[model samples]
Target: MTIIDGKLTKHYARVWDYCHELLRSNPGSTVQVGVTVNPDQTTYFHKMYLCFKAIKEAIGRDASNQVYPIAWAVVDIENKANGKWFLELLTEDLNLLDGGGFTGLLEATKEVLPNVERRQCARHICANFRKTYTGMEFNNMFWAASFSTVESEFLRKMDDIKEVDPNAYENLLARHPHTWYRAFFRTDVACEAVENGIAECFNAIILDARKKPLLAMFEKLGCT
Candidate 1:
């Protein structure tokens, strides 16, 4: 599977070219492409539309054996209203993919490829936990268990929390199953491949870059 930012058309094109090259070089081998987008980026919706368009164009009239192109976007659901809007937009996009008159991209792709699967980010799940249950001792234990790979150990910790705070335990477990429970248990290779450390590294780079003003850095680098 190939993962890329949906916004980068050049990068997407290069990845598509590489996939075609690999297929031509080694016949009878299967390849799949996955594009990841952040919902916060306003342009991502348009980018996703274009991606489907490209896939349809590439596959041509007879898409009997065309490869599958899966598109995914992650949304932060801290604010209820904004979250609702994001979900609505996602539904609209899927509707378009399903057959909303703009193009028969989904129909062409579905002729050969399977349906697209939507997935939520585990990081957003953690953030939702932080938002809903703030400043509680159980929050630490819950987060620790959610982030840890040792299932037995995590369950043991959760059991201890339930013993002390049964109400909170039950409420959180029922309310946020996808976030707290499924996130820890779901076995998706692509999602599991993501690590908090990588996000932290990107954050650190952004912080370091922000230490100097944009113009100052450009001037220092002799670009101006």
Candidate 2:
């Protein structure tokens, strides 16, 4: 389920309670929760705090069980700086590693829940690539890498690009190889699900919403 307002302590607590109850009732049953926090969104810091709290609560008090096995995905529309902010906030709050927020969360969760697997959204990764690189070559390389599952094919294209501009290859693959491109390609189906419908639907909704004043539109919809 999507928890819209992570800043509301009551709501966060309720969700945590429900998650705990669900886990307790079904021992050994794996539970996966996907969370998308837009740093540009209001109360993002609070949401990060709430996510930390949920992770801590799920793992219990013992340091041995301190690792909470929960899968969380954070989606952001801002640049890398904002993404880094969220990642830093998550690591500081949850005492995670120095890598991406999802990676840190996965490590922490695994210590307690062995079955939990964390994943990053491919859409955001693609956006990051687009933001960092400024030409069709970069775009071509990214798409080729993203769509291709075989590492050899991905690297072959990277090599092809590198032959022309070595800097591009170095820049894209400078960071963690597994986290950057392989993560998304590894689970193509998940990427397909998000890309196929959800993103388009959200874009349409956003376009429709942008045409009018948000408050007036919400009022028309009886939101308030």
Among all candidates shown, the one with the greatest lDDT: 2
On the 0 to 100 scale, the lDDT of residue 14 in model 1 is 60
Q: Estimate each model's TM-score.
A: 0.33, 0.38
| Candidate 2: 10-residue stretch with minimal lDDT | 215-224
Against the true structure, candidate 1 reaches a TM-score of: 0.33
The residue pairs that clash in candidate 1, if any, are none
- Candidate No. with top TM-score: 2
Model 2 RMSD in Å is 12.6
| TM-score, model 2 to reference | 0.38
lDDT of each: 0.41, 0.45
Q: Write the per-residue lDDT of candidate 2 for residues 1-224, one digit (tens) a residue.
A: 12432333454445445556546765643333335545566543222212424444222223452223222222334455444444445455455553322222233334432333343444565677668667887777776765555678778877876886777678667644454455243342232221223333434544543343322232222221
